[model samples]
Target: MVEIKIALVGQPNVGKSHLINSISGATLHVGNFSGVTVEKKEVEFERDGYRLKLIDLPGTYSLHPYTPEERVTKEFLLNGEYDLILNVVDSNQLQKNLTFSWQIADLNKPMVIAFNMYDEYSKRGGEIDTEKFFKLTNIRAQNVSAKENFGLEELFKKVIKTYQEQNKPRIYYSEIIEEEIENVREKIKDCRFDKRFVAIRLLEDDEDIYKIVHEKPWFVELLPQLNESKQIIKNEYDEDDLKEIFFEERLALSKGIISQVAKIAKRETLSEKIDKILIHPVLGLPIFLFVMWLLFQATFNLGAAPMDYIASVFDSISNFVGKFLPDGILKDAIINGVIPAIGAVVMFLPNILILFLGINLMEQTGYMARAAYVMDGILKRFGLQGRAFIPLVSGFGCSVPAYMAARTLKNPKDRLITMLIIGFMSCGARLPIYVLLVSAFFAPEVQGNVMFAIYIGGALVGLIVAKILRIVLFKGEPEPFVMELPKYRFPKIKALLFDLWIKTKTYLKKAGVFIALASLAVWFLSSFPRENIVKEYSLKIAHVKSEVKKEELKEEMRKKILENSYIARIGKIMEPITKPLDLSWREDVALLSGLAAKETVVSTMAVLYGGNSSNSKKLIEIIRNSLPFTAAVAMIIVVMFYSPCVAAMSTFYAEVPQWVWRIFYTIYPNVFAYFAALLAVSLIKLFS
Candidate 1:
């Protein structure tokens, strides 16, 4: 079968990714573009006896790159080899989206326009004449609703037809701009780019294009004419910046085309109605907070039932292993170290899924954008833009992707500040730790609220840090907030389940390898240097007639062995430093292991506390009875404010290259967390 490579392009939140996900039999592969940190996603599928490959370019506002993601998109479109351009536009916001459409259309590539979200558009009494759009722009158009999987087959057919026909766009700007384009076009003698596109870019004073043209032999000769053409356009438009003039021209043209081809059926948009309350200046923040609280409440309460079942299953497995294997290192390792550690991490799967599900729903329903809108004013006061909220919220899922999501912020300072504080958002890996600690220390009635408070408190602290960074490191006004609020729609259940499955699979995969190995290593440190303490205690317990006396003897032996183990020695060395925070040796080990991965914190605790036992209740009971309440609060605060895992640190390194900033990013969070824990312990002790 023949293969057609199409580049998918659009503005952010315009259903570009949703369209790619909607296609049948399509498999998406994500990677980075050459020499750039921006993510590149490609979707491949067999359609109509042809293999269609769609390269989902980063969502960019225009060819004039602003952010790193936009630069990647622009570079790919200008230089990368693709059979055709598949420009996806939001049908509801044609004029604004089509302004970008016109920019890409200027490339004169074979193209097809997909009016995505057509279902929502038509429901609002809006109608588009595709034939009329074709007549106006000379580009084939399809009204596609990727959410509903409507008109997708027809859209692909058009894509194939456009590829086969090799039809270039016939879009034209105003006559005056065209005259200048032609005037500069003639002087461009030898260049790889289309003469028309090059001429227009030259007129707009695009530095990237200017550099390319300047390297040519014809550049010195053409420079004079380029100046003349730019002057003429500037004089004609009464504007100093030809780029702004061209932008206005394109905007005017987009409006003109929309007026000619689109029929407006005036009706109240669902998004508008929902935004009245959800984005209301006063009620919005409170509503967002309540929704977040409810999300955590459901995650903890609903997940508790399944958590018990999973714990019981692990217990049965441990019991079965103990019955079959002889008392040896292998049996002890499996029962005491591996099984309980894995069980502790696995039991929180339901909570992770519920949390991700809520996040996915908010994103799919378009409420995520409104959330940014609702928080923009408050964020601005903290010297961050509204766009930072997306990445900050995504940090709750994982810091790796959240770091990548910071690409949407055009300003470098804004992006850097956002990346710096993402650790404070408390990702899913940290959820198990929070849940474990909360359940052990807090009352059942307030466990969910405590979890909620940890997350919100971290976010609050992040904002304060952002404010300080802006004042100290990056002193400037926050960038202007401009974002497209996509129309609200019912989330597809299939897509939601698929996303949740991916999250669950990723979590399990990480647990199986990273957490398992970390647990084994931790077990080695905590269980080794075989002392005679266990044997001596066993003899004493064997002689004790009273059941309580024998149980107490066993507990004493367990504590003695743990205290003398290698991990305990390591923890002891650091005890003085962490003493103010009131962290026990076991907690110090767990927190240190968390630097590797947050999930391992819980795994380390499980292996340390449960030791040779499969009963989870015993572990929780031990912690509840032994650990002081103030220390528990301090530990939670430390986890909330500390630097993320190694994987997240690597991602941050990839995103940021400055050595000074990278070093600051690494050291400051831990220092802040230590001090915060210290303060928390002190306050709690005073109040108690």
Candidate 2:
């Protein structure tokens, strides 16, 4: 079989990933490309004796590279290795997506255009003349619903024909551009590049293109001539500005082709008149809120049973080990310390998996784009675009995944803005805190609304933080909100699950390693009081213990041993500092140390308080009842305002260059926590 290299290249979020996923019979990550941290993916498969290796490039609307993702795409297309280029264009906004198709043709490559999102056109009572699209661009156009995996037979057939059969070159630039290109060609003595591609890029004032011409041997020889011609073009109008002139010209061409050959009936739109109500600001926002609330209810509350089941499984294993193992320090460590930590994370798995499943479903159905569009007006003031909501809403499921989701954006500043704010959104890790606090503090009548308040509080905090950061640290205006609202379809459950499993399995692996080590360390500190009791007759125990019963002596020895342990010593040292936060030395040590990972707070409390504080509420109760009311409440507020783990900090450090800035980021949260607690206590005093 002749191996054919077919590249799927287009602007981001045009459903390129889904098109690849559909053709490969594999669920390639079809979410935001930046979110997935994917620069490119090459997959090999065969269809009808034609072996194909499909390369998925990062989405770019224009080849004038602004960000790393767009730059990477331009470089890949210039490589000229692919036998045929499959241009994935979103059909609803063909005007924009097709512009890149014209640019691709400028490269003089054999290409077949895969009209993605064709269903959007069909549903909206719009007609597209594929022949007209082909004729105008000098490339073949085929329809496809990438989300539904339709038109693969025609797509692959075109791919096979384009690769194996003789194909004509598709280079149709304006006569003016062609004339400039021919004049520029004369100056070159010998050049290895496809002259047309180089000439076009050079005329467009691509700095990278200029650098290449200046660096290469032949271009170096003919540099002055190319520059002179470029200067002339620059004086009249830049070549990068050529697309607009061409765009208007093509629209007129398209209108002629469309008017004659295509007709769209005004019969009821396939999607119905529901959009009239659905898109209305007053009704739409409420409807959207209801749908979002339902999704959360389904993913969280409905999935609680499975989450509880997973918890029980891990919990029982710990209990079984406690029963089966010899009654010793090691046994206790295995059961209460390591196992409980692992169980705490595993319990959330069902909820986490289900959450992403719904997100994946939203993404596949194309409602996500619509949601972004609707959110745009509100989000603009908050330093967010419609796209920003995708990661933020998804953060409710889990922040780590949500952080990864921010990568879908191609703008660097926007990506950073999204990242900084997303952490403030209430993550699932913080859900247990809400459930515990809301249940304890609020009446049952107000619990649901109280829970909603805390969630909205996080979102508001996150967006404000993003907005502030954008103005002070990150330097850039938010790009205009421009994205296609793709046609909706029923999601494939199997595909959704496959994607969700990839995400959940990664979290499980993290829980097993990081949580395991943290838990073991907590066990060591907690078990020190027990470990120090090795000597009986070796010490002066012969005096008092000689008169005491064996069991009583052993008990007394254990009590005395705990008082001298290193953890106790450390607690004493940290006592003063923790006092303001309403922490005893023991709680302080746990709080100070557990800043490495929030999950450690519970494990440390389990050992320190000598109570099985498996849940956040139980732990909070132990802390509250241990100290005075004000001090006990301080711990909760502190944790709420504290910085994320060291790992998360390192990620921030790498992302944001200023270490002092990161320090500011860290110190501010802890300070906020302290004062927020103080404020809460003072407020309670006034209310009472």
Per-residue CA lDDT of model 1 for 1-688, tens digit only, reads 9999999999887888778789988887766698765657788998778899999898888888877789989999989999899999988778889999988998889999999888878987899999999988889999999988999999999888888899888989889889878988988886778899998888887899988878899888889988888888888888898878989998999889988999875665566888889888889989987886787667656766798899899999999989999987789889988897677557657766776787788888888777778877778988898768767876886675577567556668899999999999998789887877799888999998888899899999999999999999886555666677777878888778976775566556644455456556766776776558767887889898999898768766766776678777888898888888878778888887687678778766766675433455676777777678888888898899888876567557766868898899999998999999888888888887
Q: Please give the RMSD of candidate 1 to the true structure.
A: 5.6
Model 1: lDDT to the true structure: 0.82
When summed lDDT is taken over every stretch of 10 residues in candidate 2, the lowest stretch is 26-35
Give me the displacement of residue 135 in model 1, in angstroms. Answer: 3.6
Rate residue 26 of model 2 by lDDT.
35
TM-score of each: 0.79, 0.77
The CA lDDT at 124 in model 1 is: 74
Which candidate should be chosen as best, given TM-score against the real structure?
1
